[model samples]
Target: MPKLTSQQQYNIEQVAATMAIEDMPLTERAYKHLVQQATGEKTADQIAEEIKKEYQNG
Candidate 1:
């Protein structure tokens, strides 16, 4: 994998430090697809909804 540039690292760190966990949502299609592959049996929307529900209930 390519190394992250200093600016990219800083930006990621800033977001990580300031962003609320609940505010994050599954917006990346590629990641949703990966979730499908990892789980072996679920649509992306299903996965996203399940995550949203779990986070909301916590």
Candidate 2:
């Protein structure tokens, strides 16, 4: 994965801090997972399909 700039990391930290307590962990995890998927390890279509599956399962 490409390295995030200091500014980008700061922004992520700020957003994570603002998230609701119950949602913070999941949101952070999903954000990191999606970033990984986006940066080339996984295709966009695959990510969409996974999100769809999650929604359907819920």
Candidate 3:
């Protein structure tokens, strides 16, 4: 893994804190899972299309 700059680390910590306060466990889990899937793997458009398909089919 690459090192995060101090600003990046701060931003991540802020987002995590906000997520914790929101108490959105499922959303947080889904977001982390999607991020893992997305990292250097899928383009933004492809990910959006896949999500749209899932939402439509579900």
The backbone clash count of each candidate, in order, is: 0, 0, 0
Candidate 2 regions off by >4 Å?
20-23, 33-49
Candidate 1, poorest ten consecutive residues by summed lDDT: 30-39
Model 3 ranges with Cα > 4 A deviation: 25-58
Candidate 2 residue-wise lDDT, 1-58, digit = tens: 5676676667666655667455655465567755655455667687788889999999
Tell me each candidate's RMSD, in Å, in order: 9.6, 4.3, 4.3
Worst 10-residue lDDT window, candidate 3: 33-42
lDDT, candidate 3, 1-58, per-residue tens: 3355676556656666777889854465455544544354556677778779999999
- TM-score, each model? 0.35, 0.45, 0.45
What's the distance in Å from true for residue 54, model 2? 3.7
RMSD of 1: 9.6
Better of 2 and 3 by TM-score: 2
